[model samples]
Target: MNYEAFYQKSIEKPQEFWREEATMIDWDKPFEQVLDYSSAPRTRWFTGGTTNLCHNAVDRWLPTQAKTPALIAISTETDSERTYSFEQLHSEVNQVAAMLLSLGVKRGDRVLIYMPMVAEAVFVMLACARIGAVHVVVFGGFAASSLATRIDDATPALIVSTDAGSRGKKVVNYKQLLDEAIGLSEHEVPQVLLLSRGLVSTAIVDGRDVDYDTLRQAHLGAHVPVTWLEANDTSYILYTSGTTGKPKGIQRDVGGYAVALAASMKYIFSGKPGEVFFSTSDIGWVVGHSYIVYGPLLAGMATVLYEGLPTQPDPGVWWRIVEQYEVSLMFSAPTAIRVLKKYPLENMQKYDTSSLRTLFLAGEPLDKGTSEWISNALGVSVIDNYWQTETGWPILGVATGANGKKVPAGSSGVAVYGYQVSIVDDATGAECAANEKGMIMIEGPLPPGCFQTIFRSDQRFIDSYWKQHGDRWLYSSSDWGIRDSDNNYYVLGRSDDVINTAGHRLGTREIEECIAGHEAVSEVAVVGVVDPLKGQIPIAFVVPRSLEHVADDAGRAALRDALSKQVDNRVGSFARPSAIHFVEMLPKTRSGKLLRRSIQAMCEGREAGDISTLENPEALQKIDTIISANHG
Candidate 1:
């Protein structure tokens, strides 16, 4: 089906289409209206809905795809793999669900899941879905305080965790932190179902805490399905940082989520049961929920789940997993690619990536340099996609890069199967002409698979997304991008983060891409700082690949000079960085996103809020030192 026809069908007969799609699942109950757009800007798809996400993803697939492998776990250290069949996964999820219910978990109840890349972590999520409970999976690396905040918000009935999880060669004390977060909770703390990974230096299981193995054992004899969930029922609450504010919860509904995941999997993955679809996303994030847990499972495909860092044990860890599982569909972040690129290409040559049919990138926009490099290096085209916690899945992106549906560099490709996307000037809220950079917004309602709300912040949802625009349009993404003459969507950067100097708007991504193209540069992040001369000056924080060649001040200066020249050639000298700070590593969120705001804060000697979300918090101190040394 062509994109245009699919989009028209979705918008013109949205209700009928959604209802027809809902019939694809085995529902304990059916929905009333195919959709309820009466809410206006905060439109609800598949309104008056009734269904269970687990039943749709696992139960239905189990009957036919029972023997089909559903999950592939690549042990980070041992380099060994274990593939789980659909029947095996379904039974495990059922047992976990029975255990959860035994602990007082009920429909509409929330569960805090904090575990490593272990198989049980994935099971916990599907288990929640099986019993109509909402699962809030925090990244395994989150600090106690960060976990505390989320736990306090959702106030889950249970907290599923592990004693330890691997990161590189280090063992993270997950169980210890889980205790701390539970201790800090305002309400009666949720029970912690501890998985025995033995990652912690000191592990303990006391009252309100049971070993994950014991809990599963307790459910050794139960397989009952509590399928009372409705379509619009809250499946989970994934928290996201607001563009201009603090973190807000994005509520996803069971029915709508199932529909969206099915559509995305069938289209984005070009679904084939038993084929391995690997996405290196933390279970804490939305991508993990949509792709890692929901989408692949719904499609009855085997999804690879890795439990450690990419560089851990060795840089070739990811490549080895791909070869080990024959991962056919690989999705990861641009930052990861940048990291792996720093490693010797010979390392990649060690593995046979012939199984990889499609490569995907998200969490942030993909630059031309990385996209082109991946295309040439792996000989596989990168299908760079764009979406957010709000939209659920890729709303504006190329379906599959290997399908000869690729666009030019920088373009996020065209809108997905069923989305009406437009680039509009944020100042006027009017659609921009083709090739004009503007805020990307959706005109029609979101697909049924998108989030439902900001938890308790209905007014914030309206104010943040709706108030700026009239009731007619729903402002979704904070990204700045443009559509070319060929109708290809090219994402710039976040609107609030766009650099405007001498009235010419520049995206940080363009500058970052220019800086990354330099051979000396390993990874880079460009942020707009308040400038006395230009309204805002672009300052770059760079992590060089080889400190040996650029081992001294002279080498640093030479490297900066090369980067400056490259930026001048690519995006004009005016877009060149006011100054380049050489640091050991750029601070990144667990999801591999460079935290430019933190860099800007470090440059200004201000507090970098929520440093806990970072993978390496101490990296900021290095940035501070670099800034200090350069200024001195």
Candidate 2:
């Protein structure tokens, strides 16, 4: 079906539409009510159905496709590899589930997973799903303090982690961090199951700590029945950083999540049974939960789990994986693509990446320059889709297959079926005309896969999202966007990130995109700084392709002037940055979102609020030094 037809049917008769879509999954008990929106923010989907996500993902395919490769695990740190078939995956998940059950982890209990990107991590997640336990998978890189905060909020019954994890050349003592986090929090975690990766020494606690291998051995022939749960039952709780200091746990439901992800895999990624799909995201992130583990597995496709960075070992590592595995579809973030862009395209040319059919990107805005460069370099269909941790799958994208349209470069395609997206004026809450910029909102009753509620804060969920549009119940995405005359949406930066200078509101993305077009520039982040005359002036922090060119004052000045001219020629002088500072790196989250707020705070000599989410917190110091040397 074409975009308009599918979207029209979905919005017009959402109940009927979702009912038909729900048939894709193997539900233990069919849903009677497709939607129950009698309650506003506390919306319920497939209220009466009972199903187990793990069954649909693994067990249903066991009889016929038992030997089909289910997961391909690639280790970036050691260049090691392993593959598991559907039967093998099912058996492992059953074993793990039996072990969890033996440890008193019953249905509805929360289990915290703080492990590296390993095959065992995937198994742990599936095992939790199989037994109807809510899995809170924390990113491994987070410090003990951050983990403590989550542990306190989640109050999980058990914790699962590896002794250590290797990221590139650095070895992370995950168990040590977990131990410290447990010590910091008042919540008593009764049990800890540690998986030894054979990389680092681990100190096991006397009464609580248990080796994962020991549990597996004891539970060898045990079988744990999949816990069929009501559709509205919580499946997972993923913590995302909030505007306030504390993180908000976004809870997702089982039945709706399964149906939504299965539909997205079929529609958005155009995945098919036996196809090899790869998404280079750590299991800690939502994309990994949807695409890497559950989505592809539910769609009966092989999912590649890469345990290293794209540029690890060499810049050509990503291309090598695609060629080696005959991967059909690949999804990654814009930052990863930009990092790859810094390396010569010749490295990609060495691999025969003919099998790669579609490339999808999200997690951050895909700048036009990076999109164009990767499209040309890969010689495949490259598309940028938009979604969040709350929205389980792609809310916007040019889906693959006959129904999909040609992707307009840099535009996150039209809204996916079941999502009615609108660009609305912030003040009036009225829809903006095409080409006019405004806040991006999703008119709800949001479809099944969307987050049901903030775990413990229903009021916060309402206040943060639902309250913004008043009684209209629009889910405020907190993003600025514009729809072109052609009906394609261009997501501007966050509404707060919009630069208002001399009565003109400019998106940082527009300026950054223009600056990125310059040959010397590798990456760029533009922030609006306070200015007495212009209200706020745009200042850019740029990472040049080569540091040698900007090693001296004269070189820096020449390069700045050149970039300024490029911006002026591309996006007008009014949009040009007042000053450009060359930096070695840009501060970003682990998921690849540039922390513009942190940069703005550093520039203004204020506290960069809650920087625990940063991938490299040290980058903030370099940013401060650059701002001081340039502006002071």
Candidate 3:
């Protein structure tokens, strides 16, 4: 299909276009209306329909794929691997649903799932959907305080968690964290279903905690039927994990989310039945929820659920899975590929990834060097798509398997189907000219699979996402972007990430990308620090190929000079960072997103809040130690 005409129809005649797409899903009842826009920002797709996410994801596939491998779970941390057939997955999901019912969980109830990357997490999520309960899967890497806020807001009837989770050599005591979070929150949670993995000793609460094994044993041979829901009923509430302030619960509906993922799998992901799909992300995030679980399963494809780091045990861990499962479609973040790129290419080349057709990257901007390096290394097409937690799927992406699509080096293609996107000025809300940078905004009613509202706060949703700009309603992405004459869009970075150096606005990513081009630099992070003269100045933290350059003051100074010169020549002298500090690693979230705000906090001699969520707190500690000893 022509990408231009296909996308145009979605915008021009959304009801007609989406009604045709709605045929992909198996709805319990046909929708009375294809599109409902009576509430401007609060649009509904396939209104008056009844459907269940679990039925579409698991049950519908069982007829043709009963014996086919539905989920392939691999945990390098524990050195275990298992694959479940469609029939087996259905049985497992039924057991969980029965267990949830035994604990007094019913339709419209909320269940909190705090677990590591294990197969049981998938079962619990599917079970929640099966019973028509809204499941909130908080990242297991979060600290107790962070978990407390979500527990209070969601007010879950029960929390399902494991005793412990392993990350490389360390074991995170999840039971301990859950106990602490329950202590902090105001809401009284009735029950805590614990999955004891025996990695650590678990102390169960006398009256509140229940063992998962015992309950599963009692519920053996259970066959809980799917709970059908209205098209607009919420499926889940994913709390946005921002650097500061309170988190927002992003709510998603039943039919719209299902239709969106189904369409994305068929058109955007090019997923097919019986094929294997792999996404190197935790189930807590939106990408994992869509591509890892719902998207692949909805398409009747076998999905791979992996636990452990990309470089753990060996850099060949992910590729080994590709060879083992013959993954046709794979999704991962750019930072992970960068970590693998730092090592020898032979590590990845040893595995036979001939079955892999394409690798999709998102979560952050992909640099040209990283993109080209991974594409060459994998010997597969590397496609980049752009989206956020608020939007359930990609806002802009090239249709998978589309021949002769002209994808630019740094662009994440054009807008996806159903998104009426534009680049507009922040102040006047006027559309920017081609090649001019502006806020990335979408004219709503948002397409199927997009977030409905901030959970329980429609007014805040309007204020935050859909705001009146003169005569039109626009959903601000809070990111700056530019569109070329060919319609390819380039996401520069977050609008707030722009640094005003002597009244010249400079994107932190623009400077970081320039610094990353230095020959000796392996990775770089740029954060804006308060400066008396320039209001905010860019400060860089670079990771070199070796620590030998940073071992001595003279070598460190020379390397910093080279990097500054590179940035000055590439970007501009005004964008050059005030000081370039060398560190072995940059602080990042467990999901591989750079912790720029945390780095900026340390640079200004302020407390780095919430170090618990950081992938490596030692990275930030090293920076502080070095600066205090020498640079200070």
Best by lDDT: 3
C-alpha RMSD in Å of predicted model 2 compared with the true structure: 1.6
Residue pairs with clashing backbones, model 1: 49-231, 50-230, 50-231, 51-230, 194-212
The lDDT-based order of candidates, best leading, equals: 3, 2, 1
1-632, model 1: which lDDT tens digit per residue? 66566656777877766776666566676667777777766666665656787887788876687898888877764455688888888888888988888889888889988877778888888888888888887777678777777888888888888777766666677878878887886767747777786544555656777777876777885796757676777888888742333458888888777887886776676767778888999788888888888888887788888777788777887887788788888889998998887888877879898888878888888877788887787888688888988888987776652242668877777887557788887787788998888888887577777777788888877777753455466565878888988889988888867998877789998899888877777888898888777888899888888877468879878888899999999899899899887777878877888888888877766777766767887898888777878778
Residues 294-362 of candidate 2 have per-residue lDDT tens digits of 999999999999888777788999899999989999999999888888888888999999999989999
Task: Please list the residue runs of candidate 1 whose C-alpha ends up more than 4 Å from where it truly belongs after superposition.
Answer: 77-80, 201-206, 241-246, 401-404, 468-471, 552-554
Which has the better TM-score: candidate 1, or candidate 2?
A: 2
Clashing pairs in 2: none
How many collisions per candidate? 5, 0, 0
Per-model lDDT = 0.79, 0.89, 0.90
- Residue-level lDDT for 533 in candidate 3: 93
